[model samples]
Target: MTGMFPATSMPDRDWWEALWPDPSGLLLSLGVEPSMTALDLCCGDGYFTAPLAKIVSGRVYALDLDPEMIVAAKAEVKHLGVSVLKWIVADAGDVAELIPEKIDFALIANTFHGVPDQPALVKAVARTLKPRGLFALVNWHQLPREHTTVLGQPRGPRAEMRMSPEAVAAVVEAAGFRLLRVVDLPPYHYGAVFEHKG
Candidate 1:
């Protein structure tokens, strides 16, 4: 993931959770079902992965490119003492190889802008998902200059690197996904939900 924000940029686990309060609520708003099998692509620090494990009846595959991030995520979820999660240290684009089972949902949050090959990544997600499976993406919205230049911004990619919702939808559609809906995630982000055409 060249030209991407490094894992070091991520805050401590608690701090990160505080920043994105109520991840479960957000997932539910995005149509994440409790019994669905999910793949948390680039699941850094288990911010979403841990909660996903709690909700999903099947399994949650938490995969990341950074080994340290995976280690931290595993530790973060260990308190729950649940075996619903399979933590894998791998690129987000290798979902087909890394996850053998057909996924009911795939969540890519906050890291889509940093992905080196957007089309390839989407294709991989499509390949791993079951027919009509959902792919939810939460990404930083590319706003105008005035909105993005806040001093001492705690997080988010560079302004130029951020992808607009339209841009994201094009990539998703090119990979054989049907764009379903777009929702405002509030506080500087938006979510796009798509379904694998199969």
Candidate 2:
């Protein structure tokens, strides 16, 4: 868990999964179903990706900026006998190209904070998702000036890239998504669901 995060994650997936253990259930609460096809953006080690694969019971594509993490996730999925998932590496922009258009659901999770190009990311998300598709985003709440950090600096105060629910909502809305549900997940993270505008 210590090295897994590389100072770039909300929390490494293994550590976070151990704490919450119910992101899949949370996704279910947001209407994720076996009948749908889904994508996991920034899926680190297939933590939520595995569960999403189960939930969709259809097609699952897990995208990650870190190729090492994607390789590890693919290994885990193979060990788990989960074959419906496809692991791909590259930025969300590359994902936008590969998936083309109209996926039923897409999730960014805590990865939004790591993305350097906010507009390109939002536009890519908008382009790939179907109208009415679900997009779930999760991130940490804002903290005071002395308790937050970015890119490994205990630099005091949450960076803008470490988007809050409202901030992420703004981006999604601006990209043609509408807010749907805001959910409390494990301790330091939360989830927001949105629907692509029709």
The candidate that achieves the highest TM-score relative to the unseen native structure: 1
Candidate 1 C-alpha lDDT tens digits along 1-198: 532344225555554555468888888877789879998888887778877888885388888878888887787677666554577877677779988789899998888886767899999999999999999999878874356433344456767888888999999999999989998876678899999999
- Model 2 score (lDDT): 0.71
Candidate 1, lDDT over the whole model:
0.79
Count of backbone clashes, every candidate in sequence: 0, 0
lDDT of each: 0.79, 0.71
Q: Give TM-scores for every candidate, taking all chains together and pairing residue i with residue i.
A: 0.88, 0.82
Model 2 Cα lDDT, one tens digit per residue, 25-133: 8778666788888888888877777777877773888887778888877876676666645667776766788785478888876666656666677788777788898
| Winning candidate number (lDDT) | 1
